[model samples]
Target chain A: MAVTRETLLAFLSKKTRADLSKIEDGAELFSSGVVDSFVMVDLMMWLEKQTGARLNPADVNLDNFDSVQRILAYAASRAR
Target chain B: MSGKPGIVVLGSPRSGTTLLRRLLDAHPNIACPPETYLLSAAARFLHADQFAAGLRIGVLDGLSFAGFEEAEVLARLRGLTFGFLRDYAERVGKPRWAEKTAFDAFHLAEIRRLCEGHVKFICIQRHGLDVAVSLRDLVDKTGGYVQELHDYVRRYPEPLEAMARAWIDTATAIAELADSSEDAISLRYEDLSADPAAQMQRVFEFLDEPWDDELVGRALAGTGQVGFGDWKTYARSSVDRSSVDRWRSLPEPVQVKLAQICNPTLERLGYARIESDDDEDDADAARRRYEFGLLLNRMKNEDS
Candidate 1:
């Protein structure tokens, strides 16, 4: 299954119990305290299960997980 | 303790001290432990608080009454604390030991005095605002039980401000330590993240220890020990520079506030000053987001 922006949003919303509407595509998640590191670890494992491959540490970082838009782009990049 | 410590790692919490400690600990000749709070606690014993002062005098007077000299009392204190460290180092098959605890940054002079010229200090620094960001994140993640940084966090109403103050005070103490101590060396966290191998080489050189390719590999893998240090470090398999400018993504008001609070120390430490708002376009956000996600995956793997 492909991970989309809405998929990531729904996950974050469920995990953080934050309003989905309040979470912006470009909003900082980990840095802004919307999502903490522990949730991030869970999300990363979920991403690996979805993508069907283990993530490379070199490829893993804040650049791919800080926002819904960025995460989708990361997913798209990994799909390629 | 069993042996005199040859190295002391000093830095503000979140300034990459844990990473450095893991690296130093991996070295064959050096055994760096997790935060022991021993040196800092010893420094506190020397504090001039009325109660502590009275206790020290009372103990010394009692010891004197028992024919124990002041020098002997001091020697006993050193033995009791440093012996454990020495034993740990020997148990780990390392010839020398190093200790790193964040609070020890505030007590460099006292630590040096107590170590009696047997210690060399390695002080690590990061841009104050970046440190402030992580510090705020830590307090949020842990729900205000950051004992490593408890002293600064409790004083301010705002987390960022409190974190900024911590960076400022710790950086200032490190700066003073570098200036006054011939045995002290300073390393920037930005530089370390930029090239950890080179930075570790520089550190090994400072300690007069041999640097090996295997040591860098071990350092990059990190110690899996769970303790009071940065939890994020446990997940890191390699150094990444994404966190170098993380403060740039902060809200403009927050950026300005932290910049104002930390600009002096930032300038002193040779980091750029954020005098006003800077643009962080969507592209920047995308880059940072991707980096964070990747770090998360690595962390997850380590967690499992």
Candidate 2:
């Protein structure tokens, strides 16, 4: 199944201590300091495990993983 | 002398010391251990070996010199520490090495003497309220907030207050020491967070190492979990810049208690007193000054 933005957001809200209410689909996560370096690692690992998607170090850039929408798109691209 | 320049990253615990260590370690020219509380251990060992022995065993993972004479113990420990650095550098294939430990701040004089002019120090500072909140959060997560805080207070008697005082004191000490030597730099965690690439570039320049743009970009991208455990789902929450006014966030009764307890140290550190306009009738600026004076005297006596 292609990962949807809602699915990613739901998983993130449950997994993280962060209040994701303000996090829109295309918001900048790191730039906003909503997610720090350590949490980014956790989010990536969760995405991989939950979706069976393998993410390379190069693919972990802020451009790809900066927001729920972007992350979902990256995962969808990998699935395709 | 044996390899490249050695760096020491020192700060209060939970003040982004480990993160700075990891960031610098990601640099190609530098190497650092996972974490070491050596300097703090050294201070405790000098003051009271028994207490230091327990800390060494518990926190340092059985690294101790409990049953030896002071000079012999210090020499042995220093040798072991330097040897570990050398081996770590060789293993990592790096010419420069760095080590992070909060306790090192307490024993800056001793660390300087031991490194024998081979070390550069990077001191990290974070807002005290955030530090306190982070500590509380970790304790709650680990399921031992009360017990841990109680144990910490039992050991240190005034861990939070002492920690706040130490943060200012250590920073002042390092700043003073650095005035005479070109071997230290202080960086605020907030500033580092706000502008990581620029801050990291300054860090590399300070160490006289070549900056690797790719590594910096990767470090900025951050390593996704190599594996998972308790911290697997941990997400860095966005901090409200205005949250530094944590004094106003607590209940009135708690705020009063905190003000009473931490007023002297807070004033000493130049933090303005939190006074409610509604309660201006009860505020005593004169008494606060007198109490601050007394606290300063007490601190001087303890230091001497």
Candidate 3:
């Protein structure tokens, strides 16, 4: 199954302990401190587990994971 | 604590800091409260010199407010940060105050410089697997002490691995910082848990407090901080030896994965690696070496 925004949301909401409903798919997670650098590494590792997407340095740039929508797009792009 | 004496407890998340804080707080003259989160909460007020509004801003440490709102708001209330804590201890009539934060290790020097009076630094270390498992348990809660590894909770291939990475990175950084700091004492969680009275006696002596058999007795007998978190260590008076050697209960594969991600750190910290089949360990080592060779080959190909 293609990983969806809801899938990313559920995983991140649990990981961040954030309120699931408030996290719009478009919210700026990285810039907003909802996810910081150390946590960002863990998120990349989790993304790989959920989507089988291996993240290199390039994939971790803000464009790919700054928000839920971007993360979903990045994961889909890298999925095997 | 420029004019008065205080204690700061530092540890990896779940490394028994709260327990230690409660024990110290149990002292008659000492008041140890829950985390203040000072560094992170007040970082927006800092200037280029790391001071908030011309006053020294070295009070908070381990906060990653790299680029936050440059609100001058944090500057206006700079005195309130340390003053509030100081006045609270005075109002409560306790001569001493203690703050516990795992990130204190990152800002030890700055904190020591910020304070004019003597500040005793104490740190605790725990095994990665046990901390990881406990962190895993906190994945579902609304509010828990898993404040340290909040991002490492998830399914296989990442959770334990990410936990291992966090443990390694943090332990290495904190250990080095603690080793280099003056007036700092370090203890292992296993040693403290196994022998509370003796370990705590050493701690009491370090803080220049006369050890009362009563304080140790109180810490062991469920006197205070009972069920504070309501999870594993919350409100429990007695240390459960059951938490020792938890890696044995983890699946063997997960154990190996933890060792792989955390091997260098575990080895550095003198924690034993998980036992594995010799053939399997050898094969995995060979595979890693092969992967490195492959990466080198790719780089060479690109260069050519």
Best by TM-score: 1
How should the candidates be ordered by TM-score, best one leading?
1, 3, 2
* Residue-by-residue lDDT tens digits, candidate 2, B209-266: 8887666455434444232211311122222244345435443333454455455544
Candidate 1 per-residue lDDT, tens place, B1-304, comes to: 3353468889987899988888888888888778888988877665443364455454555668899986787678777778778887888888898888866877766676677566788989998888888877877897865464676666887878888887888899888888788888899998887878899898888878888988868876765766667777867888767788888767554675677778888889888777763333256444544665566667456545
Q: Candidate 1 or 3, higher DockQ?
A: 1
Q: In model 2, which runs have C-alpha deviations exceeding 4 angstroms? A: A1-80, B42-76, B106-109, B143-152, B155-181, B220-248, B252-304
User: Which digits, one per residue and each the tens of the lDDT, describe model 3 over residues B1-304?
Assistant: 3344567777766677777876787777777766776643443333225455564443232233554332333433445565666776777678787777655544444444443244677878889888777655555464632434544433234666666666666677667757777777888889988887788888888888778877866755654443233255655768777877776666444566677677677777778766553133356444544443354344334435
TM-score of each: 0.66, 0.53, 0.58
- The CAPRI quality class of candidate 2 comes to incorrect
* DockQ, candidate 3, vs. native dimer: 0.02
Worst 10 residues of 2 chain B by lDDT: B227-236
Candidate 2: residue A20 lDDT (0-100)? 84
TM-score of decoy 1: 0.66
Off by over 4 Å in 3: A1-80, B1-4, B43-79, B102-118, B143-157, B221-231, B278-304
DockQ for candidate 1, C-alpha atoms: 0.13
Give me candidate 3's TM-score against the actual structure.
0.58
